[model samples]
Target chain A: MRDQPTGDQLLATARDLLREDVLPTLSGSQRHNALMIANAMSIAMRQLQSGDEPERRELAALGKILPLPESHGLALQQALTEANRALCRLIREGRADSGQTRDQVRALLLETTRQRVAISNPKYLG
Target chain B: MMEETLRQALAAFIAKETGAAEARISEAKLLTGGAVQENWKVQVDITGGAYAGVLDAVIRTDSASGGVAVSHNRAEEYALLKAAFAAGVTVPEPLWLCADKAVIGRPFFVMLCIAGTAAGHLLVKDARYGGDRVQLAERLGMELARIHSIRPPRPDLAFLEWYEEAPALHSVGRFRRYLDSHAIPHPALEWGLRWLERNAPPRGDIVLSHRDFRTGNYMVDENGLTGILDWEFAGWSDPLEDIGWFCAKCWRFGAKGREAGGIGEREDFYRGYEKISGRRLDRQLVHYWEVMAHAAWAIIAIQQAERHVSGEETSLMLALTGHIAPELEYEILTMTEPV
Candidate 1:
């Protein structure tokens, strides 16, 4: 059997197809939909590659704002860890309000993570 | 418990007033885009109200969660809308205000629905109405200038407090406090704030300021701008703030080449404003506020994104708002750094 295409290969192929065959052909509402879909895909790929770094950095930053009892570095790490755990619990319990709060916590974490990653890993593309 | 009960109460109240007894109230979905308050599309058929036609009115109220300092109370906002409408600004007519908590669990107002489009990207992209865009942009500028020209002797509207004082310092402190409350660290934003503080613009002749004058905030029809919505942030300040805000890059809706509401050149808007106001354009002041406008928008975007992430509200729009921070930051950096 022929070797299966790797995830990267598949993503590249899909992107190329979208840019060449799909985007050029679209018009009106179809063009809008295609553009939105392409944008979503690009975001998804970027998130997959560099999303975690932002999360870590954001957690660290949060620690500075709302100081925990632990040391700075540990607090940063723990606060983020606790935030994730809290989010997991809220999701599992199906608490709608809590879910919303968790989203804010997650956003802060992710944003901080992204900024930190950008500073640390200059070559990282998103 | 409250949301469902509130909806029922609201329907009952509206039904009683409108005299449409058979009106069936169904599905009250909370609409997005109002940052400081909540807006919902309440679909109901007339059963027994004073007016017999089917009613589709937007119910607006203060949000339970995070809200900004400058947000007017529902009654106040309604009053403002009525006053603005009276002044010949195209606005949805304010219908009713309910302060009774038993009705909607908070103070809220209802307004007649105006049919028009407000999406900036869609407006810019649609080739059918491309020719009208520049003319519409100019009209919008002129109309805004008209709004600023309104000097109030009316008893209903409260006189703006900071009219006599230097507004730049006040704004600097106000924005600084807002940033401090959020406690998000941004050295660049802080630097911009400091720059504004150090080089505060001299207080010019004061007039009305539509604090958030931008493309998306306005309503447009086939002819041109029909209405300018979202006066929650409206107040008295330097008129240039409004002009600068309208011309700011963030409001350009992804069309970089066209500057005036991303529809035409800045001169078109400037010419229109000059025609209406009888004042020569201050290019330097407009440039300054344009930088500040982006900074303000960036902060707002951050706040909006925060709501999505913090779980107060979750929507794709909010998520996208967060993504715009980088672009806004870049704008501030470029504007502030000397050539």
Candidate 2:
């Protein structure tokens, strides 16, 4: 809404320029560096494209697992941090090892990790 | 030039260490591809003495920064390379170690550099090495078996802690403790760790494990593997740990089709290992350790990313490594979660 080229669009253009236009001219470590920059840009673009959907979904999943107040006046990132810390405690204490809890925890962890992988490296999903 | 000064120092050190009358170093240049260590390629020509030949060698020393927590120091790495060389593991011949800080302002060691490419992507992608992938994979397995031939209870390897329980359990516990200390709370990684802990096989005869034995760590040429490099992470553990680590999907460098280090099939590697060690690889046990491999790599990726994130050593490579964590975590879930 603000401009013609959005954040993700600009990032995608830059990444393509680095990979297709600039990368072929370089070799050895310089090429490797350029490729890494392109990779980082690509991940950033993916995150932007996905928006806050992954974060919101993760929070929803965490709310069911952790004893947290829904609709609390906490930021999504803060809520995630608190929920993950509590989940870690439960896992470490062996409370989430067996029965229905383990299945829920596993499913949530898998879903959350899938979201991360989708942003970071979608090719790895297969 | 700085190169001339380093050359003179290196020649003088070589003369003193080998009791040579005179030694001259030439063509000294830094080699790439060791995030934690610096390797300088040098040609050393010695006059009449016990060491009296022109040699293409590598001067390996610690980098200014970005050393892994689990790796050995330069002196220790020199000893490890020496032990591997003595065991005929196709490693570079360790020549001399200079522990004196006065020599190069840090500890360093020189070894005879061999010919080959150690780039994982190149080896996995190139069609030139396609014909010999099976043989190369088997030879690597045999070489690993030879490395495992060196068992524990040695006075030299006394620094390595022995595990009375299963070494797999020890590895799981160590990684869990590392994660707990960080307190970052990676549920997928935790799930993998829990699986590893529960499925750890009984401790077999503890042998020297090349903890980082994988595709990227070895050198291969048109003919075959020239040298098995990087001995800093070598330690005593279950032999199968190396096998799992070698075949781990994460280390395949995008050549996931060829499971054995992305070079050849697993059966050939296992057959080669069994031929030497007389012990068959347990497929199920190896699978558990493979899960552990992903978890361990994820932890390392996190640590590498921290080096950049914490501003301790700002490196693009380290920063990129952090992006690999989610992928590794995803792989851990696929392997450990009920499917």
Candidate 3:
């Protein structure tokens, strides 16, 4: 429904401007600030490209062991946050100490964490 | 004239401390890029005093937003520096401590300035600085052993709280307490901390640890290390904690091949440490502490990010640091298998 230049495309273009043009003109702390801005913009662009699929996948994974409420009215980010907290509670109660539940909890954590790292810093996954 | 007035007050204070007839401050410049402390480089010329010389000095004090509660205050840090200096550690000479806030709007301490760069990003890649990497690492280890030589039950360092519980558990409790205040939960941190609590080694080899003894915290000239800097995070803990923190993959700054702080082989550093401490280290136990090191860094990264997120401080660097936690969390998970 949106226009041709999407959020991700706009950020990618802006970051290109910063890295290609503005970065060469700066020095010292100003250069460092510009680099950080470019890096942050790149991260935003990557996240936008990935969209909400990762969070949805994480929520479905969390629902495997922990019972999910049918038709729970919440946004994707909020739902993931609440579900993750519940999983943390389960982990602290020693549910993830041994047996199949432990394996399941670790799998979800690893899968979801890898997805997050991929978004934040994909080179880390490599 | 306001700057002149402050300079006069500072010069008068220096004169009294150095027993000089008059101390003339030629230059007083504030250094940048410290969140917790403010360092002012003051050039003082002493006239008719026991310490009569042209001195390049640095005066350190708390920032406008006073230092975080965890670090030592100005006087305590000065005492720590003196203790390290006395113990044969390479450190700047602690000259004088001013407790009277009237002198500089905050209590401060003065020390002789040393020349060197402490930036990890540069030190790791550029061999021109820090000389031979192997000797630099060995020297760092020896310096650490000297710092660990100072034991507890001292009236001077009485400000450091002694803990009956294992240092590992103490850190876990602290991480948990801090996470409780955070808006969102950190499941990976909780899971990793659980592993730490379960596998914590008994409190036996307790020694003073330079909690932030990584590549960036210390300064090194082209020849070798000039001085071990940033004594704020020093505390009593297992000596291996420092070793583990030093060797953690996260501290390596992209040079993951070289283990000893991305500078040299771990064996050389350990050899220097063993020579000084007269004790062998358990290399296996250091693995657990390495995982803990990642967890500790992740916690600190969160703290930095929160400082920016809460509007307490607006810093792009701080915001970026928060993003580093996932990689650390991944490391923690990789190291601590559920089996």
Q: Among these predicted structures, which one has the highest DockQ? A: 3
- What overall lDDT goes with each candidate model? 0.69, 0.84, 0.88
Candidate number that wins on lDDT, 2 or 3? 3
Every prediction: chain A TM-score: 0.48, 0.93, 0.94
lDDT (Cα, tens digit) per residue for candidate 3, span B1-339: 227887888889989987899998898888753768888888899897877989899988876677777888889899899999999999999999998888878888999999999999999999988998888888888999999998887788888878988888888888888887888788988899989988988878677788998989899889989999999988888888899999999999999989999888899899889989998878988899899999999999999999899998898899999999999999999999735
Off by over 4 Å in 3: A69-71
Q: lDDT of model 1 at residue B98?
A: 84
What order do candidates take by DockQ, descending?
3, 2, 1
Model 1 DockQ, alpha carbons vs. true complex = 0.04
Tell me the tens digit of each residue's lDDT in model 2 across B142-253. Answer: 9999999998777777766666888888877888787777736787787777777777788778899989999888887788888898788888998888999999999888
Fnat for model 2 comes to: 0.69
Q: How big is the positional error of residue A61 in model 1, measured in Å on the Cα after superposition? A: 20
Per-residue lDDT, model 1, residue B339, is 79
Candidate 2 wrongly placed segments (more than 4 Å): A1-4, A69-71, B33-35
For all candidates in order, state the fraction of native interface contacts they contain.
Answer: 0.00, 0.69, 0.75
